[model samples]
Target chain A: MESLQRIDLVGFGSLLAQLQAEGYTLIGPRLEAGTIDYGAIEGPDDLPIGWRDEQSPGRYRTLPRNDRAHFGFNATPASFKTRLHRSEETVLEVQRGEQGELRFVPVIPAVKKQAWIGARSCELAALAIQDRVLKDSADPDPRYAARREGVFIVAVHCGQAGGTCFCTSMNAGPKAEGGFDLALTEILDGPEHHFVVETGSDAGAALLERIPHSQPTAADLRRAADAIEHARATMGRHLDTDGLKTALYAQAQHPGWEEVADRCLACGNCTAACPTCFCSSYEDQVELDGANARRTRHWDSCFNADFTHLAGGPVRASTPARYRQWLTHKLASWHDQFGTSGCVGCGRCITWCPVGIDITAEASRIRQANGEPPK
Target chain B: MPPTGTERPRLAVWKFASCDGCQLTLLDCEDELLALTDRVEIAYFPEASSRMLDGPYDLSLVEGSITTAEEAERIQDVRRQSKQLITIGACASAGGIQALRNFADIESFKRTVYAQPDTIESLATSTPIASQVPVDFELRGCPINKSQLLYVLNQALFGQRPTLPTHSLCGECKRAGVTCVMVAGGTPCLGPVTQAGCGALCPRHNRGCYGCFGPSETANTQALSPHLERLGMDPPALVRIYRTFNAAAPQFQAESQAHERD
Candidate 1:
């Protein structure tokens, strides 16, 4: 039984200030162009307060919330992964020497000590998933590793679930398990509004000691549990993980893929929105001077037609094959490779998909079509 | 791979029926243009240079579409003369805005737009350089990307291969942290079917992509039309978007033509 402490609204501001004092660039949910996505922020004021996000298949919009809760929003398109695993960056720069000898210089980006505030539990799980995908690989991504160094996390337990969320079924959210400096649950009970904070690490305890906080009351504990419970109960989506990887593998030749392919745009939107996807492609840019060149690695997706391009042409020419590759790799092959499912069940893939391609629904449909009974 | 000797490879820039924007994209390279010229000899570029150097060129960048019969014949000779021929921009790769004449009666267009129809002599339809002869590579875009032009030139000069993505512009938008206007704002966007390389210019600025770079490798504009309708895009607007700079592109052309019958 973990005892939780209560931090008042003003104390939340100081917590942000203390993080800044400790040399961390704050990043969290922000309102930008009719949607709330993650980006750099100054402090608690920059948080998307008094706003809730509406997410459905192929649609997303931010609406005003009645209460001043920063973490009321759902999964955003831009995650902590977006900042850590960069889209495109010059990995190596080659300079032509005076004698025509090439000098290959590696470009290691200057990483900022960032405190990602108001991170959802699903996003935190995504960070851990990416650690295995990018860092634990044979050819580890140093760029991602560099950007992720010495970063602090302020996990926000979801008090509200979006229409497309399936974190409860994925067992990734509503309540954060681990891998956070501190975990916070926003409890809004009548006139009382405060964050029930739980220290997850020694660093969290150190920061909490410096901030204004009081021992949580019995009512506060009940409300905090109730808040997380509300999210779990309202979840409108689910992914049955019982034999999911095996079922996805067995449904490789299923016609459901082709049926979905008719609608699949192969735009790589799902891959972009998915926080756990780690596929990438490299582009070599030769300098105009013909003196030096640069090699850049950018995020790539299996959805791209040319993703499987070989010497002759693309191996997976049809949209069905590409979609299958992505789905299978994310759910099935991912387990064989990483020992865990690639999806964190944040539902950004469903919400951000231009045509609303639901991954879990597709998986369920394909499994059933292949004669696999629903769990 | 610097040519056989210390001599720099000869580079030729040709135009057929374009705004010369693609040629200017090379000149627009400015500092990079100087660097490129330093590496390769600019044998003939009527836009920048008056000096005309004859055949057997190492690399040739062909711009615009083959509209006139003379251009149709000339591209064949140019193909024979040059070791490598790379098409630059929509006109050379797909047929440019002039290709709109393809969907309509050219004779009627000539009479309506031009007074002396007999004086003008062109093929019934404006065709790309690839339609005339085999193209080594194609650098996509309406006006073409300067970085890609330089990259293609670098590849041709160094005897290397160019790797240009034919992926959707949605990837570019995602990379830059730009939300999907189609999904988030319900704004009809062609980013899903359009090829990348414009660095997601329009979507980054909070507007829809007009698909100036043409179609992606797996473009499904057929499936996209229904969603565009859901976003409040009318039939004509839907037909019009696909019939833009890259109209002659098979996928967009099929969608635009399909909607035309509807």
Candidate 2:
């Protein structure tokens, strides 16, 4: 059995160096453009140390935590998927030869080995959902599979919760349950600041050997658990998932849909912020000379009129229909399609929505309209 | 391919009352512009090339709006000479920011801007090409996206229908995985009722949609107005919101008019 170890702040930096030496690009949360966005990190200094985020519907602000903690923020609008699955990619390039024969060339992405640090449990859950949708499907997405291959995940158990977070309601966070090579719990007890690290794989155990760390004490374990317990208790939102899919599916004519649609700009901000939304469209481009053509795939949304554009016109011409399709697919139909809910309850969609449309609140309303008791 | 000596399909570009931002987008397609020259002949484009050619052109991409009486007559002539007419950008598709004159008194505008109002001969209302003459296609955007422009050109050349989105901005946001700025931050966005184009630019930057692409198909401005009101927007603010770049568009025009005090 693997044992939990205690690592100091300095030791964490060393681990980052070790990952770099192993030819892994270290990606973690860093303050950029006034928000904590994930990007390449060299060491602990590159992280958003002593910084925290305040998130509410349509509001995101960064503030100084006045602490030495590196991962003080609960979640960032940028998710791991941005690194795993690119926003735009060329799938194929076509050129006509002198003989009039068309030559097609496939565009493949360059290989990049990446290690993600400070991933929260909800993000991990989202990654798992993406794996099933993009990797474990009948026709696996080569682009996603290529980028996702050999990714080293270092998960952080929540010590704090954001104002828009609802991972506890989704049963996906407050603790690093699985899908990580190493799970870290930051324990801040008085003046003592340390981390309890548990290895989930042989590669994680092997990497831990390179860092200066000691076996965790019984008291260290208790503190780690307590920190996660506090995060769960302090979650800002809750979503009752009991018969949620059925309630949503049944409430097609719910008055709340019209109310929500009336407020919806149909701008597609929610799906863009959602970690699990994976719809895309193909764009065909031809050279000015019309000699060569290329087809590129870019992220697309269901809220787009072109998304449902048929020979005659758009099927869901109304904003209400488009909003209905998005909410239903996200909270209800996603279960039928992926055997799981699309939302991990990270609350990114809620936080990033310009109009401050809370999905949890909408779901509760829908459930209530379907004769289901609210939480 | 046609013989080297065979005349290529003639192309022309026209402008009226606009900032020429959409025309700049054509030039902005640096790499694609070189490739585009091989497919279509640049018969006339004052912004790009001074080399002018008489019309009866195969395709004419029109930008801006009909703001003056002379411009209205010129557009009819351009429409008569061109086989296919495609309106590009907010100015051609809607009335653009200049269409703000449609609501207020044009006589006051002429007097305020010009030293002598009698010297200026302008139309009472700024109007889109489709309103003046039949337009084959209308590309929406403050400055129409280069990729969509290319798609329209390619489809037009190949005798195929263009696949432009008439859906709401919400579709782009969903596909891009952008967070809902309205729900999370309580920011008032016009994304739901607005047309999809500009790739959801404002919302991606953690801002609200400004309705640059105008109203989408079946835009529910009636439904969205109350919601904006509930979010603390007063009547005057709502009027201003709908009277932006696409103020002359029927859906937004009616909505703004409904909120107008006088």
Question: Which of the numbered candidates is closest to the native, going by highest lDDT?
Answer: 1
Q: What local lDDT score does residue A160 receive in model 2, on the 0 to 100 scale?
A: 89
Write model 1 residue lDDT over B228-258, tens digit each, in one string: 9888888888889999899899998999998
Where model 2 places Cα greater than 4 Å from the true spot, the runs are B1-5, B19-21, B24-34, B46-51, B111-116, B145-148, B164-211, B216-244
lDDT by residue for model 2 (A107-202), tens: 867668899999999999999999998899999888888888869988899998999999988888988788988889998877989899989888
- DockQ of candidate 2 compared with the true complex: 0.47
The TM-score between candidate 2 and the true structure equals 0.90
TM-score values for chain B across all models: 0.96, 0.96
Q: Give lDDT: candidate 2, residue A328.
A: 84
Query: How many clashes does the backbone of model 1 have?
Result: 0
Q: What's each prediction's clash count?
A: 0, 52
Instruction: Pull out the clashing pairs in model 1.
Output: none
Q: Against the true structure, what is each candidate's TM-score? A: 0.97, 0.90
iRMS, all models: 1.4, 4.0
